[model samples]
Target: MTDIAPASPRHQKNMYMRQNKVLKDKVESLELEVLHYKEQIDKLTLGDVPQIVKNWMNEYSLPWEIFWCFEHEKWIAELDNLFPYHMENCRCDKCES
Candidate 1:
């Protein structure tokens, strides 16, 4: 016969509490990181940018145009063919003359 010593109820509760605390800490840390990333994205889209830069981007083209530019090289190449002159003239806010 095997002698098995089960954990006491108090010990099991303590272990569960400790595991819960660790999980909570990790979740809080991940939430903080997500908040920081959201702040960075907000800065990119709406804050931190100068008015002149915003004006330049507004003049350049649609949001999808820029999104597609970075999203896929193949799309850019196709766009380059369809709008060769416009593509040549297109510039991001930072690259605007």
Candidate 2:
């Protein structure tokens, strides 16, 4: 009768290595897709926002203008608390108008 031996640690290690390689390839493919999407987003919007935010805008058609307005208001309130006189005389477009 033939004795079937258990897989050695070396064999297990090789199996794990192959699995890791497959996972690495998948991760790299996903990363490339993310980069492609980022390039498309950069072409669409000529701004310096994060890629994730830009992608979210593109995917969901979110109202970024409204978000920016609220963000600016929050920033102004925080800045005003920190530097009241400076914020008051900032003379930026939002502040002026």
Candidate 3:
């Protein structure tokens, strides 16, 4: 069997540099995507969001927290849909449904 030669130091460095650049570019792209998503979330929270979400936003100071709740706890949005009329008029601490 033929002996295999290891890569030279310079070749290894260039490969590492190329990998680093690729990783940096990926990170930058991900950061931009995150920023875009954050902007969209901000727009939704500040602009034409659902009234239930708006009410929850008023109740809780943090908009993202409320949005997160709606995302993870789908029952909240479902409950809101179930009782839209009651939710509109009522302003109690706990919703019956």
Compute the lDDT for candidate 1.
0.55
Better of 1 and 2 by TM-score: 1
Q: Model 3 clash pairs?
A: none
Between candidates 2 and 3, the TM-score winner? 3
Candidate 1 TM-score over all chains jointly:
0.47
lDDT scores of the candidates, listed in order: 0.55, 0.54, 0.58
Q: How do these models rank on lDDT, best leading?
A: 3, 1, 2
How do all the candidates rank in terms of TM-score, highest first? 3, 1, 2
| Candidate 2: residue pairs that collide | none
Q: Which ten residues in a row have the lowest lDDT in candidate 2?
A: 71-80
| Superposition TM-score, candidate 3 onto the true structure | 0.50
- lDDT of candidate model 3 versus the reference: 0.58
Best by TM-score: 3
Model 2 per-residue lDDT tens digits across residues 22-85: 9999999999999976765564367565554456457657544322333233212112333323
> Quick one: best lDDT, which candidate?
3
lDDT of 3 at 40: 63
* Tens-digit per-residue lDDT, 29-82, candidate 1: 999999976765654566354454345457655543342233221122223333
What shift in Å separates residue 18 of candidate 1 from its native position after superposition? 0.3
Cα-based lDDT at residue 42, candidate 1: 59
